[model samples]
Target: MQPPSKPAPPEQQATEAGSVTTPVRGALASLSLAMLLPALGTSIANVGLPDMAKALHAPFQDVQWIVLAYLLAITALIVSVGRLGDMLGRRRLLLAGIALFAVASALCALAPTLWLLVAARALQGLAASVMMALTMAFVGSTVPKARTGSAMGLLGTMSAVGTTLGPALGGLLIAHFGWPAIFLVNVPLAAVALLLAWRYLPADRGGAHAKRPVFDHRGTVLLALTLGAYALAMTLGRGHFGARNVALLLAACVGAILFVRVELKAPGPLIRLAMLRAPVLGAGLATSMLVSTVMMSTLVVGPFYLARGLGLGTAVTGMVLAAGPLVAAFCGVPSGWLVDRYGAQRMGGAGLCGAAAACLALSLLPASLGIPGYVAPIMLLTASYALFQAANNTAVMGDIVPDQRGVISGMLNLSRNLGLVTGASVMGAVFAAGTSDITGAQPAAMIRGMHASFAVASALILAALAIFVLGRALSKP
Candidate 1:
């Protein structure tokens, strides 16, 4: 007779069963905070811009750099920082990033000059890029593979919470403690995150004897410059593309060509071109960008539609606009749970179908049905987006090897950010083209613009769905 084996250790059992143990919980809390801080940093300052401009004696155009600097820094450097984490150590880099973020937040809070504050914000963005990139990278190492979607969902929830909380929290803080309070809030949160990460997160593997790949400094610089140019081209003119925008865009195109050439010839490339040729990764990135573009259209066009088309007051419009993100925030965890239950590829397809249907409904139904109609479709769109995000993130990150997680995670984030930038430009243009003098347009013109915008959005969602299906087909042997 064979003897019965002893039960696995509590930690091992919990992992095997895909349950969150104490250690896993702590790690998740740290990662969630990491994700949240960057998101908060992105949105919180928007509410304080007026105060900041007044205090610093800067014009609105110059003050806008306070936001732009941070965004540009993140967009330009995210992939490089992710690669750095992969080369050095994610835990080490992430801890350093958290510490740096706290210091930069203090610098922003204390800066006396506008440009100084902008510089500090840029520094803060650099740290945020590391945090954002590495937090997702750390997921595969921290949780059981079966629970990757759940972890991703939790991180998504934190991101939505931070984004949603930022405007409201910043308003209250500014009213009570001034604009600096917005930046100062991050200090304590970062400190707590630092402690949690130091104590609970897993240490990096390998030792001094393990061989490490060479850092691609040339590729990094070229890619950063390329991305910076592209971001500037997309963002500089605020909705109206001008001569400088065209010049920057052209420069970006040239820089991209040079970057690809440099990367291909390098002995140890920053990004393996072959990896992009793989149907799954390439299609994942493309679909992510497409989906993000559609999502951003709602933000770009929703306010105008509510205020002009429906004749809602500013307060009511704001509240109605808030509903989309709130739905997304609440749906995040459940969406992840569904991804885990049904599998990422399947859930991803389901989410895309739902999104397409919602977009079509928004395009056709909202004018006749009014606020309830608009709100319902927006809610469905956001919920579908949350599901798609969770599923897509899981599908992409779940199969990545540990060595490449950081860079791959960075690529995923980069794709989404690029989509946002493009959406703000292209979708805004489409909306504007659909209406004459958008600010003073009549209800009919506003409705027409809204319909045109959502119709385009629906098409984008359908394209993403096609890409998803094609990718799955091609990935099969």
Candidate 2:
């Protein structure tokens, strides 16, 4: 047997011809903080929605737009901005994004009307897209190739932390101050991140090193339309199903077809469909999406089961639910170590198995078993997501050349967002279909719905596992 290789040190390298050396330590902290803000921002407002609605005197339908607008903007614009980062410069774009996020956050905090707040949130989402797209690009560029998994692990850790904190923190802020406090919280985080990023991050040397690529204006627009329509359809499918949802879904399908055609012919495609044929890249992305779908399903369904099925209060349910993301956060660094040592495929497969097991456990366990039973499966599901994300991200980014990191990162983020929305749509439909009448749903009916949702989620994860296996088989030497 071969002796274990020594781990690689965190070393700096020049990301461009004339760029300053990538600061491994500082860059990790800076990038993690930058990534954390948007992740937190995405969910922080969820707990504040009711508070905001009350304060603004807005109906539930209008308040829904606050979250929807942000999500839509990010989904629509991230890939284009990521490609822009590849063209213009990651550092330049990141700084601009941070500044914009801060400013928009302020606007959200001060907005007197629901419509104005929604608009501010949209702007914040645009800036967030830039930050989210470039996060891996910057990290991948900063760290040595050998330690990419470790760095990605740290990024995953921050993401888990942000997700865990968002709701709890938002609730606290809303109770103490107001809904505006939720938005105001971003100001300090973004400011600190911006300062650190400005001081330690390198300039746009990657763009300088590579030949100037033509911007694909047409491709960007079509892709944006596709994502926008798709997101809207998914969001609407949760409840507001009718002509609007059908029309938006149809529009999404048409936009997707148009995007494919445009990209195939465009000199500078937003996403290279050919490049996506690579087994590692394509399979990694698919696995990422599936993993997120499973995770999101648990997230959306678990709370309902806890509160409605088990008769737990919101506070207790929230605490019980918080266990998953908290475990995920703790799992990140160790999972990164595993990825760096063992390669992504093994870890990714293991993670998927864990997810499948968690889904099965959740499906089988009765709500009568209470929080104890839920805790174990939730931890497994959350940790599995973090594990899969860390390894899959390393694999995908590793497969790409440095020059295209921004777009790939954007694509990865896009997949995750899509998975989240898709999971919500699919699982929500399943649960709703099972319940038939939510307002008059009995505990038994709700429990049945939860079980059905989890069963479907497990089946989906198994399918993803099969796909991963096939991808490996096809990629073999």
Candidate 3:
């Protein structure tokens, strides 16, 4: 099939070479800050979990919901909102989303009860979804294609720093002030991003002349319901669904079918699913999900091992875990160079292989290895995570037509978050289900369980790599 015919939108085309404008860079810088804010809260909150339960007098379930609610909202809204940006205006959506996110963050910080906190978290998620989707679309629209790889790399690094630093900052804040410090941290940053964006980012052109713009409401509803059901099934199917789990799983399958149906039929489709028939695009997304699952598994299972099983202090655990992403922040910009040289395909394969090896090391970690021994494996895992992320994102966006980037971004980004949630649930199931002969005094049981979990993680990553290989081999660039 001939590639989608898209002469650059006249509004965006540079008719003639022009002098440099500092404001565009200023706009990107502001966007990078706004994009990083959501991550800060997410990573930091992991460390603040105990404090949250204590302050809110909340049960374990309430705390889980707080995180889940935020993720769920993001998962549902991101793709649809990205499509909204494509139709309405990327800059408009981005600035408005930032404003909404700021308010939600404030409400979260001020929340008096667990339910109130959950509600605020959901609001935060929706707002974040909009911010993330539009900012990415805006980046693509604003930058020349030749420079897109590098632009995306810097943006990825910013996000990595936010993600990596979140916990360390949270740990420090909780130690010094209290739990609310986490949400409060976004205030100044958000204000700065808001002000800079208002002053710098160029106005969008998509809806400038349309009196009655078409909205893809059917596609949006189908996508939301699909993801919502899948989230529910995953949440409940972890032994909670019993005999009905299969039915719930089938329901999720049905939702996927319906989502595709709605997308194909909508006047303004939520996602151009047919476009993603490209094997390269498919590979990129599959690898993205795998890498996401692997990284998120660490966030989920690593804490338990540090705080309880091995008896390390929570603060120390957060710091130790932060090592990988901290290193990744430095590595992110360099990854763009690698992607340019080796292609995202090779880089993704290498990343998965490295992660698999890291998992193997963790699986085989001997009791005699001690602290220094385990650090290498952990760092390798996170670094490979860093490697694949910048690369995989490039590959996906690389193959897509410019106009469809937001939809691709939304779909791939959702896949990554879905992987994040699934990782926790999957590893949790693995940890909870398996019996260990080694407990109290005998450490073998704990080691065995951790090893099995790592091995399972490795298998998942490998599966993703395999899909990438097959899909990429089958598709044209």
Q: Report RMSD (Å) for each prediction in the order shown.
A: 2.5, 5.1, 5.1
Model 3 CA lDDT for position 93: 78
Cα lDDT for residue 131, model 2? Answer: 94
Give lDDT tens digits, candidate 2, residues 200-305: 7766665355468899999998889889998998888474578998899999999999889989999978888998888877887887787777777777787778
TM-score leaderboard ranking:
1, 2, 3
- Evaluate residue 180 in candidate 3 and report its C-alpha lDDT on the 0 to 100 scale: 84
lDDT of 3 by residue, 354-389 (tens): 888998888777756655566789888877877777
How does candidate 1 fare on TM-score? 0.96
Q: List the residue pairs that clash in candidate 3.
A: 438-445
Top candidate by lDDT? 1
- Backbone clashes in each candidate structure, one number apiece? 0, 0, 1
Clash total of candidate 3 = 1
How displaced is residue 458 in candidate 3, in Å? 2.3
Q: Evaluate all candidate structures by whole-model CA lDDT and list the values in order.
A: 0.92, 0.86, 0.74
Q: Candidate 3 — which residues are off by over 4 angstroms?
A: 1-21, 49-57, 174-178, 206-213, 235-250, 304-316, 434-442
In model 1, where is the ten-residue run with the lowest total lDDT? Answer: 8-17
